[model samples]
Target: MFTLTTLVLGLLTATGISSAQSGADGTGGIMAGLITPHAYVQKRVSSYDRTGANADAIHIAAGATATILDESGPGIITHIWFTIASPEDLHLKKLVLRMYWDDESSPSVEAPIGDFFGLGLGQYFLYESAPLSVAPDKALNAFFQMPFRKKARITVTNQGQEDVDSFYYNIDYRAYSQPLPSDTLYFHAEYRQATPAKGWTTDWKSNGDPLVNDKKNLNGDGNYVWMEATGRGHFVGVTMSVLQNQDGWWGEGDDMFFVDGEKTPSINGTGTEDYFLGAWDFGSHPFSYASFGAPVKGEELAGSRSSVYRFHLDSPIPFTRSFKATIEHGHANARSDNMFSVAYWYQTEPHAAFPPLPSVEERIPRIYPVGGPGNAGKNP
Candidate 1:
């Protein structure tokens, strides 16, 4: 019988203070408890679908507890390991690892544990025939390696159907003051465009022409737009938001995103979803949309005026002189204006290879309007 009392006790007992531990060097030394082992047991709802709609579902009574054992690191985290124990066989689709940094307001970083490494998404990451090999009473173990900074809290989420009665985890981490080889960097550029008429359609071009006129024209009004930094570091994560005026064109038509020299894929949904790197949409709404996809192009169609957009890179990116964005297409109803705003950030180091691109299922679409009478037959 797993109770809250047991869970709390588990955490407390697992976190016994380390009186003194030997340093990496054989020389005698005294180290604080910073590198000591810490543990936590928590109950969470398994809610995430990796595959299609037919994916398995997780149905467990609320308050099922999971014990997480964590070891602190010096600076960058090298790897993590854990195990899961369940009363019955459970179909797991995916696993999410979230890190709560010193700042409790939000997690420093959160990603699918399997996907973070080379492991594929969802059950695919698991070995076929054998989901995982864990004895009834024994603890299963796994490992994860990544470049990390500062202290962090990690959480494992089960996305598979079936009930996970209980589980235990042991995470091993190595920290160092030396930065990783790959560090993320961020840069910003400003763009502005003007159109001929109030209802005229135009494309907001980045390199070729400031004003573009074609079926894909997107920038409507002539105002200053801004792009901000959402994610940064060696595993450079990029995200931005767009604030625009007017509303007519479909959500897909008016948004665009460009990385390096090529354009990214588009995302599904509206508002922030349409915005690149936007993880949360439907602000202050009844329903919550938590779909994550690869980066995509964005455009603005309906709303004009000033809109903010964002971009994210999974790894450290080279320092380029400039990056650009443009409105692919816009509506012909109200005049649409587009502008660009910029911000800058720096990474500690660079990575060996360019970050991996997102999968098709994880791709996000550009920004566009949804569920409005004015937005009809406006996408290109």
Candidate 2:
């Protein structure tokens, strides 16, 4: 039911008219009366290498390439650009915009396209930009309203640190049939810890070792514990240690981290009370320990009495993957008897200042039971 000479020969064969073109309302030659000769072209089908020596950072590097532009169905991706001609100062941090239909382990949807002003994942969608200009080429344009599902994949990741060598992109799928409704959000994160060692007393030179100075228990020696899995993706950093026997506190102790198992309420005014990211209170007075960053808000650091806490989530604890954490005690008289010698090392990889080895092997056997009664007669 289209006749204006078949909608001006389907808009002159979708803007490619040429058959001795003739348009002046006489409508005798508008690509031969009603355009429909297979239109849709704006291509650049391949490009790859997201880093040197087999990707995944080995020298602070970055790389990316993917393009398939509309193969069918209502389309108008307009623009999805990139250009960071490296010159230094490219700490761009997280930029993942994935839309892979039926591949890469069944992905039908995903989103996070060049988010710099709107944080992304950990929550803020877009509102933070200042370092994308290098001499004359550092661009980013977004207007992706997509809907051509049979096949599509666009992945761009460079979680900030500046060193993004090169980039330039374009994707404008055109067509029209009415179909647009998909914004993408699938989220993921995984790292676990805990096994067969509860509350206290793992037999450290036994004599009912709950700390009469079994080196302050928990296999002491500058003791350090960790655990933090927040809003889902952006905190990227952590590595833990402790497997039994060291007893004799003096290198520092207490570095707890258990952010999303609920129940972190204990911060009562001090230097860092947001779930205590760092602590080494050797009975205070001149012995210290503290380090913080990220939205970890206060209180809940109670454990000590022959302590025994072990945890490890190395990196990728920001923007969810999957989480759970436990183990807290820092002197209060030393005898909380906590014990979890192993389990807690998750990964998605991206936080290496040094220390890398533990990417999941599965271990679980510590059900909370050592030096019971919650500190039976506490005294420091």
Candidate 3:
């Protein structure tokens, strides 16, 4: 037992703590990359001018694909940054980001450029988190390390009608001389949306009748699924966009996670806002944290939209056989609202194919009342 414990401790010291310290982040303190030198070459692929001239940003024409990177790698993609200037607010949703690992025909990471940067509604806002962030001037940044043993291909598709006049980007990676670990997994980000989620058919707002609309949810049936995955891996986190079609707070929902095909969810949360690490309807304030944040807080009223995200960098939910993650539309599933999300995780190969991406017109963030257009434009 003593020998086993010593060996395990040594392994953890070299792999867990030391590995992070010696990553692309080349600075900090005693934990520095230079301390334990390894055979890895840091490289960058960007929209830098090929000539010594000044054409910095690439102009991706409408309905065209831009291959930002196609490289052979026993390497890890360390960082990614992008910024854009366009007239369409929906361009964020229309422009797609796709990345395939080990030369896979299909992309392991497929999502809207904005959603991948933690801006769910296809809108830009300055916010910061551990893994993703958006700085001033709509500069987006992502720090998810994606490892590939063979080859990696990354592309951005302009599905919009108008050209992306200026699309600036930079991708940094580290080429490793040694092979990746046996447990190293592929990074995947799949986008899902219920442009308008189904909820109670009628508006139950009677003056005298008090309806709590509360019920217990077991078995995880009919829940708004974020993503369901098979094999062994860990859940990183998700970015969510919520658009309110009714007049009032639209966040009474709870989060549920089913691990390994279990009938009951081993993990559950109190409410939507609570699961995002905020309370009292997020207090209608923008806040950023290392783990979770609500960078864009819309007014708690009809026609409002909010973007929120949570990253599980420190505490990743592990699953051995399978995992299914879902969240309620509202308390007891009682709200009809627009919802868009992207769930990020790292897992073994043969990932479940993602649901079809909705058409660009469907993703434009529309707000329509559940009951009808009788009381449209009016909050209450």
- Report lDDT per candidate: 0.30, 0.30, 0.77
Residue 82's lDDT within candidate 2 is: 51
How well does each candidate superpose onto the true structure, as a TM-score?
A: 0.31, 0.21, 0.89
Position 219, candidate 3: lDDT: 61
TM-score of 2: 0.21
Candidate 2 local lDDT, residue 115:
24
Give a tens-digit lDDT track for model 3, residues 155-193.
999999999998988999878666777677788898888
Clash tally for model 2? 60
Q: Candidate 2 on 78-180: residue-level lDDT in tens? A: 3445544444331332333344432334322222232221221122111111111111234454322333423445555544445455544555554544332
lDDT of 2 at 231: 35
* lDDT, residue 367, model 3: 80
RMSD of 1: 17.8
lDDT of 1 by residue, 1-380 (tens): 54333322221121110111112333321233234443322222222344666433333333332324233322323223344444432222134444543323343333343333212212211211011122233323222123233444555555444456544343444444343233322111111222211334423322123243223323323212222223332212222223233343222234433333343422212333454333333222221111122222223334422222222312223334322233332322223322122222232222122223233223211223332223343433
**Clash totals, every prediction:** 71, 60, 0
